[model samples]
Target: MSGSISRRDVIQAGAAVTITAAMVSGLAERAVAGPAIIPFSVSVPETALRDLMRRLAAVRWPEAETEKGWSQGVPLHQLQRLVDYWRTSYDWRRFESQINAFSQFRTEIDGLSIHFLHVRSRHENALPIVLTHGWPGSVIEFLKVIGPLTDPTAHDGRAEDAFHVIVPSMPGYGFSDKPSAPGWNIERIARAWTELVYRLGYVRWVAQGGDLGAFVTNTLALQKPSGLIAIHLNLALAIPSPLPTEGATLAEREAITAMARHGTDGSGYFQEQATRPQTIGYSLADSPVGLAAWIYEKFQAWTDNTGAPESALTRDEMLNDITLYWLTNTAASAARLYRENNGHGPNQGVVAFPVGISIFPREIVRVPRSWADKVYPNIIHWNELNKGGHFAAFEQPAIFTQELRDCFRGVRRT
Candidate 1:
């Protein structure tokens, strides 16, 4: 063979062979000595599909809120329309087929079966980048950007802009195994990412993330793990130590006011998830409509839509994510993450690695550049977008893709 063997080659060769528990044990032994990447696929059982439809059909709706609009959470009429479509017209298999078209697998990392999509570029010397998703979002968030990122030439860009992309479902969020005990916080997640990249045989790589993904990426930069060249974050959770208020600009003042408003009015879900995820989990796991309403509220609040979620994301796109949570029975496990890392603040670390930031207009807390500079000392690139919101990749994939291509051009390794 003239070409060097890549990790994908080993996975492709073993794709057909099924590994039993005993074989997995043997692989575990081998893993201690070297990398143990496995090939995997997604196949929801027929029974599960029937069950989801049945549940959607038999929903016991709550009465409409006295107040109009989203001030009181997702309106009853909006949710009903969404549910009707989900039960009558939405297609889960199509979403499954879309994701399954890409290469996916589960590998044991720190005793958990972590699921990820690994797509390699055909172009030689492509930069490897790992993308992580956040709460209420799954690997589906990056589905739209994967092709454009991995094969830029096919998507109206230069081959040099190509990237070998890896999108991982955060533990307990999607197909990834839920943590049995309690120690899987942001820091631990970052360490597992480091191991995951190394196991995939990348000597040099970069990372990008938003929401909870941003927290993980920020931690990775702070840890300064070996082989990580740089990182880019859409949600900058930068808080100055001891808090400074001596000199503030108009934007800074506005950002502070927004932060206060979020703390007061928009943190009910945060407080509940942080304190009592199990309680809400019961309602989430049993009632499909309940789960839809819970998540749908965030879609309305976070996106740049003009008071209507459909303005930003289609009903199909929203259902695709809601269905992932429903099928995986991950509603509770996912929420418990908030409890696991309660009181966790993103402003403590001092990162020395090069950092790039793309600030969307409607992000939860619009941290001013002055605030971000306090934590990320070596800022290489920073841009403020006119549109987009919390779910940048899911909501504005083209803009998100272009942002990454432009942001990483300076930091790309040879």
Candidate 2:
């Protein structure tokens, strides 16, 4: 049998089957001892769906914001409108069917079951790339780009640009098992990703991420794992310590101002999660409206939108992500990542591996090339995109896919 599994084989199988790492890689000695990879299909219980609908119908909405336009938080009218659609029009099974169409699986990594989507390209030599998602996001974030990435020929690109894509749900997020204890930080997650990729038998690959996933990808670069030839980040962790107050370029000054704004206005959720995840977890786990509002605020703030998040992402797209968290009951578990990092951020030190960076204009912080150089010592590719925001792939998948193709093109040979 070939090292790679054919999509037809996966599709033709009528039901989920057990596949071990040894079977995947033909490296029995190394993989046989590891956990078996179990086929997974997203089948939410009817009871859970009914319960969610009931909760949505019973939501106790708060009064509208005092000032117009998302000042205090997600506006009451906006949330009510979204809740109405969620109750009346939104369909969870539709998204579930879409996810099940792709190949999904779960395997234990460091005593935890990690859920992931693995899509193999028909192009035999397609590069393998593992994509990671952050808080308020699940494996669902990457669904839009999977088709374009895995089948470049069908998406108006050469076979050389194809990628065998892997997207994993971080610990305590989506279908992945929630951490039972502390110590599941970014470093630990990076190690788990290394074990996952190598277990699948890829001799060479790259990685890409944004938001909290960027921290994990940056950590992968820092770890310099075998087979991980390079990495790309949509959100650059390039902020320096003792942040330069003097001699600031226009871009730098603007970044500094943005940082200050984030510190003041944008960091409420950060502070809440970093300091008291469990406290907030109760409400997140119990109240559907609370979870929606919590995530909805970020969508409004982070994406490249014209006053409304819908300008950047459709109503269904936003609901798909929000529903993933709600259905999985992962709002609180995902929040714990903030507490685990303890506000450390990802700028630990110099990353010696080759790195690629795409700076979306409305990313939380628009990192300058000069700043990024200090952290990523061997910078290979850098592009400042005209549009997009924190959720790059979700907002502009075509641009995001093209960025990966361009950034990793140089290192594909190495």
Candidate 3:
């Protein structure tokens, strides 16, 4: 019991292991000491698949909502239809194979093993960019955009637009190890990401994120890591505090109203995750239907769909993300991130580094240009699209890809 501990001590203290069914097959390439990048792949155990099917089969149905729409929750019929497809036609192996085709790897950053995809562009001088995913999402969200960003020529873009892309599964999510002790906040994550980019031999790079990822990117901007040049955010966490009582623009007023509405109505999950993740964890970890309903509600509520999540993303796409959480048994660990952050809203610190903002019409709280300018003085790029929502990359990969291309184009020159 020493007051000051060593890195080895920290690692040992935090290395509380819990192996879920899915992790039995996909082991990291022979363990190397000290931050070594080891090749990794997803080979889910067949028993895990059997267990998932059995759990889905035994789901106890909940009564339909009292109303017709999603006001109460995910319409029972919609969830049933999705669950039916999940049980009958959904293919987990297809997703596994699709993701494995990319160059995936795991490395020790700090004390945790971080799982990431590193896809290099064929073109020379390709700018390196790290993409981060948030809760209820994983690297699965970026599968569609990886091609366009990594190989611009094949996807109708100039070679100059190419990005040597890196997408890391956040700590406590996907293939990454869950934290046993507290203290994996966004600031630590930003530092770890900087170390990640440096370890990968990148001297200069940019970052992009939405949701929780956006918070990390913003932290990167604040940290001003030696190599980090700029950051792009689909969800700008820059809502001015003391929201204007007078002289607010039409856009600002609308945004304020939306924020207020979300605080009142849509923050049930936020409050729960931030305050009592362990309570919800029991339901999420034990029941597949409970987990599906929990995430599916966000897909339905957050996406720019006409009425259902399918309008924004396919059943397979949504299920791929949801299943990743299920097989990995990461529901509670992921929710703890909210608790780590203390359930703060868009009150992130100001960022002076060059910043890019893309305002999706249906984002949780679309920050007006006025507020963005206040937070980011060197705003390099700002665009407001008529479509898309909170899960920008998962919903509109094409538009999201183009936004990154246009965003970094200005900085890539200087």
Q: Which predicted model would earn the best TM-score?
A: 2
Name the lDDT of candidate 3.
0.85
Residue runs of model 3 more than 4 Å from their true location after superposition: 1-34
Model 1, range 1-414, lDDT digits (tens) per residue?
Answer: 211122232233244322221111012212222345677666676667888888888788889989988888888999999999999999988997898899988788998878899988887767889998998899999999999998999898888788889899898987888888999998899999998887776767899999889989988898989878889999987865555576878878888778778989998999999999999998898888999999999999999899899999999999999998988889999999899878777574677779999999989888899888877888888999999999999999999999899888886743
Off by over 4 Å in 2: 1-33
Task: State TM-scores per candidate.
Answer: 0.91, 0.93, 0.91
List model 3 lDDT by residue over 136-204, tens digit each. Answer: 889998989999999999998999899989999999998888889999999999898888777776667
Candidate 2 lDDT tens digits, 1-414: 211122222222234443333222222323323566777777776667788898898888777789998999988889999989999999989998899999988888999988889888888668889999887777878999999999999998899888989999999988788898999999999999998887666667899989899999999998888878899999898898878989999989888898999999999999999999999998988888898899999999999999989999988999999887877778888999999988676477888889999999889899888889898889899999999999999999999999999998887776
Question: lDDT of all predictions, in order shown?
Answer: 0.84, 0.85, 0.85
Q: How many residue pairs clash in each candidate at the backbone level?
A: 0, 0, 0
TM-score between model 2 and native: 0.93
- Weakest 10 consecutive residues, lDDT, candidate 1? 20-29
